[model samples]
Target: MSSRRQYQREFVRTFFTSPTAVEGDDSAKMLRSASQLRGMQAPDAWIPDNEDATAPSMREEGVENIVEVVSEHGEEFPGEIHPRIVWHRDDPSTRYEGFQQMLRIADPEAGAVEHVDGFVIPEVGDIDDWKKADEFFTIIESEHGLEEGSLSMSVIVESGAAELALGDLREEMGNPSNNLERLFMLVDGEVDYTKDMRAMTPTGELPAWPELRHNTSRGASAAGLIAVDGPYDDIRNVEGYHARMEENRAKGMIGIWSLTPGQVVEANEGPLPPETERWLLDVGGSEVELDDVEGGQAYDGTELGLEELDEGMYRLEDGGEIHELDEEQLRERLVEMVSYVPSMDDIVDSMAEFEAAKEAGRGAIAMTQSATLVVDGIEVEISTDRMWDEATYQAAGTPIALFRDVHEHRPDQHDELKERYGPEVVERALDLDV
Candidate 1:
């Protein structure tokens, strides 16, 4: 083969092949070692430090950081002391204690704090109760500045009624007098837009909300800033990060803040690219020009419309309608899981006993009759049955003994029962609704 062709083949084999053949030659190792020695002999073996002091300084001055906020879908609170609407299942004390723990970092004193910000689901079924809850928060924000530097409260936005009245929520947040510096919208269960659909704060996906930073003005964009909780803590890709930061800057999001220095590093990673120092010099305007260098359209800029922002991630927006999958969809997903039969004879016997209990008119007996049919580790109660009918079994949604009846112990009685119930008795038994 030609020398150039061989080189090309070797290069392709190294990267494209699943596994490349190792060269039998050992001379390369010696040559590489000698080269390393040559390098060590040279006095200029040095590591490089590439840290930028300017961008962070600029951000510190006032530029907002772009944060993609998130929170666990099911849990309340991402372990922070931001605002939230708390609800309880017959117990408000637990929710109150949770807020107290979250605010422990703030050195919260129990008695000095005047009012507990919470609301009860009115028994009259009137949704005015939710309005009352929101009003309570407005009252707290209006009053708390005199005593403590901050107010911490939770509002539970979980119910059909609350979901419908989400507009009431948006209006409260929109109110200029209501100084809700940090608002947390806690969604517990399915909320209807008509009753209680509130925009999520600390916002990103459903539960991950950016902390709502309050602005002095109450115009359309008054709720201008959102701070993501638990800021980034890793700095693996500084260049890609700064590029995103420049994108966010263009999008009108201002400075980024982290509670910990570690998070600051993570947040800085993307905004501060690998060649950020050089790129900063290259772009060298009032704001970094990430789009010009990379040659792709800038991350959705401020000039772009909200419909364009939809192409990115879905976030909680005030006065917008959000729809989740219906119960049928949820059930369909659950039914997709695999179902397997068990292999325990003792469980089968126990289930048989339980079946006997049912035939005896003892209502429902709990026992292990078969490995497949079990309750709390005990099997089905149908003792004499074997090899259940797969089609009829699944259609019935319950287990029926394949062969014998409860009176198998008394063959004569078993025959009589079969005559009365007929061959389809097992099917009838299976038809009993769980």
Candidate 2:
């Protein structure tokens, strides 16, 4: 909270479909407000005078200002283009189209352009691919006479392979030889990740928590780059969206994408203080200051060494391999080793966040006593206290509807509700997923 805003690894995310060239000036004919950004370079870049008529200043009729959003979040989330990798695979030309979009997004010869700030690259699978991208952009910048770092870049990791290569990705980004910006981890990679693990349930939760936890921490912290997280997919699931952004914030991610305009409020929230913040103050194993020894391993003693092991990971060794731990595992062991009592304020804050999280997740399924609920005149025993057991799921009587949280309409089965509730109830029932 300073009078002058700080320039951290900032981001402001918004995306608009590049208007189809064939759609042209007539595209603005449907409009009240400008459908196109004036003064922005076209996604196809410079137009051939004979073939193209729309200028860099937008079609004259579409010249009225579009809505502008200012971020009160204090962190600048400047507008940027998201260059997707699928285009690269589909055809090289389309990928370049994305690049053209990036170039024109913010660069305006006239007045202030559309606040274009940077770019985020999606689905980087390996270091080789990353290096190629780095070089590609380097050349592109040179060609455009754009100074280095003028247009920033961030990469998203969503696939399982990309998940594993996160360490290498961060290491490469931090290598100084490369100019790749932040690495963001999308938590619910959904089917993209699940298809590899073959383990995702219908609810879209990745049971592999460590796969996610370490990705954000290692990428965001180790590489010292802005860590970005997923846009909580459900636009209407405000509680769930807030809870997720909080988790991302706790993991040190500076930003989360907004799936809808409303969800930007959740992404804008500052994180509650991180549970444990540490630095390798004593590099060569020296004694440091100490407070009341809490649950963490008191490290005031000498012989503590934090050194790089594999890329993107540091080992906390007490002089040798006899006791070595990575960041996440090390924290767990320290918690078990000591009961470092935090100040009452810290305790209160932690508990409050904990309860809020519990409320957000389990809050959907209200727990009450057993009751007979009739759906379409069919009586079914419904127990709010206990969800449907494995036996109940298998029994296959009248569709056992435990839809309090909308779990019954599994991702694969849409009409199951319609099949059970009949046309009348189906018409009247609230959309639980909403």
Candidate 3:
């Protein structure tokens, strides 16, 4: 293939993964949207013992601990905390360490094109320690060009003062600022019966902490600042991404759902929006179903042979001859498949038969690992390639192994190949773990 075509193919495959690649009117809008919905902030703290303060090796040990964090997560970026501090502080250090680690990962240089939508907190007291937190956030703001809504505080409403001040803190820090993004108040600690009941039942049911009640009387707070509140126990079920997605979507806040490999097919399989389907068809010239025809024998939920219904439309027939459908139904289905990106699961399922055939040495799946080849230092994924150059591999002294055959022979030749080509040239193949 020519370089231009190769570049075009790569551009499409890797396109949507980048934040900037998502549709937006302009750079400012993209950046703004990212700031509001995509940034992830985590806080960590480290507590040092009195004896450790005087120990000569304490600092070195601290550095090693930070190194472990980075090693597990990858390299830290410039302007982010030097990992040496993961173990350096006491009280608020763990939260601080996590914050730095997340920031390190968020740096573009670190290739963290995506952000964490969750906030991680290390302890309860540290969550309420604002003075110390202010100092830490100040350093963060100065080091990285963070926008408001990019970072949040995991507040712990342990003490009466903390609970009382939660609203105030939230109102103060809700919007974008030079110093920080946002604040989240998480209540964690031993709680009395009255406080628990009141927190759970709504504001008026139980007697409130005097300090907190007095603070509330003082004023109404702004949104976004110290926005996260509630009984810690109730919050547990809603902490993770799936629950948050549902909640956010209900609130009209879902822009994109970051999917794992398992969820991708289901996510993609969703009925496509009419406009999007039209756009994709116009742009990509994708195959469309023509009409409903008897799908030979029903071995599965799907009919074996699919019939195109119209331009960019297809229907599955289960032994029945073509039947006329209302225009509305046809338009709806046309809109669906055209816009639908199959869920990762469905997509994988759709390839099961082909992959099985490839494994059995019958034929290769058009766009899977079965169709990939390692060339030079890159992996040429040929699953999307319209035509295969079977002779090319035969000429290169490389055997045209079926997906299974390659695995069977991989261990024997892999080490030798790596030695001869240098690790970089064989890295892609090795990643297949065959």
Candidate 4:
């Protein structure tokens, strides 16, 4: 098996901020916002966008804004700073312009180089193209007398060849001349990718391209890099944004591109475990939770094996004893029987218990979870037992791992996490080892 490079920080969210341009003699609004973002609480990594977000006529000015703002405020910012530079695989002049800008931004005397973590190369082609960009960073580092491989490279996959380039990374890992090891993130750029593929839709919107996301996730996992989804442009549709995030979460791609600070907050909190436990039931092939049903108005009493006792009442037999329930009580009980998602506290307790079990020479153990409710005057209970082995323990430790990473990178979020998860749970999570 080949060894994967270890990264020091977590990448839950990457916020892209475009450099501000002077408008009709007014001051730069976007540049002011970029400086103010040092106090914001979302992105784990910040990108001063100088490519697609900036107008061609103002790109040189945009580069200056990045240098000026980042040099002054990047130290106080909680996240890593990576400025997106212009690059085109087929265009020599554009590539050279980008190269020259990189040289200026990375110069030791510029004062931004010390705060800059790396550069984001956009519109890259294949593995050779990736190497070419990596070589540029290497030359820049050498020119400035900085440590080799000190500057990292993240590529935006906007073409079919760029999508396929991910698979070639594992084979090219052993090359010592280039800084492929410095590669950090594999970010998808869906809009340009759609144009590159010549794809079209009735609505003229970007396709979901789930295969691309899955491939990106798999490639990131195989190469030990972070996978990030492209931006969800429907900024005002907050629910739609979260729904998209849930989909990306299912594919193990926690990081995403944030176009606004609001989106950044959502993306930052999207990956962490829920604050409270939730239950769901399969109702006619659709999953329904307690929140889905409004006052039990839409539910019939027959769901989840509840025996209807009256027009608005029901009875449930818990191992033979009968307990009476009303419409609202019945709806609540039914949802709890089908599925359960553990909360952060629940995870910490389980991990702590599992550690104790392992120390006591046990390979596996059965853990029981129960839900109880009062019906009429009797207490009815529903319980579940899951066997936890080493594999299961490791799987449950993902949230803990993410928490530790956040705790390490963003000390500003420490009090917020403690307030959310409690100090005991936070401490235990930081101390946990897989």
Among all windows of ten consecutive residues in candidate 4, which has the lowest summed lDDT?
292-301
- Go through the candidates in order and give the clash count of each: 60, 8, 42, 0
Cα lDDT tens digits, model 1, 184-233, are 22222222222344655454334322211111011113323121111122
Give the poorly placed runs of model 3, Cα more than 4 Å off: 1-96, 118-128, 167-181, 184-434
Estimate, for each residue in 1-434, the C-alpha lDDT of model 2 and write its tens digit: 01121224222222222211225544433221212222111110111110012333452222221112111110232223232322132246645654554444333342222233344455555566556556666665566555655554555555666666666754566577776653332322433455555775677664544446557556556656555554455678887766665565455554555543345434432232222323222324442333323332234444554454575455555455445556566444433333222322332333334345455664322223333322122222333232333233232211112221122212222354345444444433233111
TM-score of each: 0.24, 0.43, 0.26, 0.87
lDDT (0 to 1) per candidate: 0.26, 0.39, 0.30, 0.77
| Residue ranges of candidate 2 with Cα displaced over 4 Å | 1-7, 10-94, 103-114, 174-177, 181-191, 195-199, 202-210, 270-434
Q: How well is each residue in 262-296 modelled by candidate 4, as lDDT tens digits? A: 88887888788777776554555566553323222
Candidate 3, residue 258: the lDDT equals 24
Best by lDDT: 4
What lDDT is obtained when candidate 3 is compared to the true structure?
0.30
Cα RMSD (Å) per model?
A: 34.4, 22.7, 21.0, 5.7
Cα lDDT tens digits, model 3, 218-308, are 2212323222112222323333433433342233221222222222222211111111111111112443332222431112222223344
Give candidate 4 regions above 4 Å deviation.
Answer: 1-7, 20-28, 38-40, 291-305, 309-337, 373-380
Task: Name the regions of candidate 1 deviating beyond 4 angstroms.
Answer: 1-94, 99-170, 174-235, 255-260, 265-434
Which residue pairs show collisions in model 2?
11-77, 12-77, 12-78, 294-339, 294-340, 295-338, 295-339, 295-340
**Better lDDT candidate (1, 4):** 4
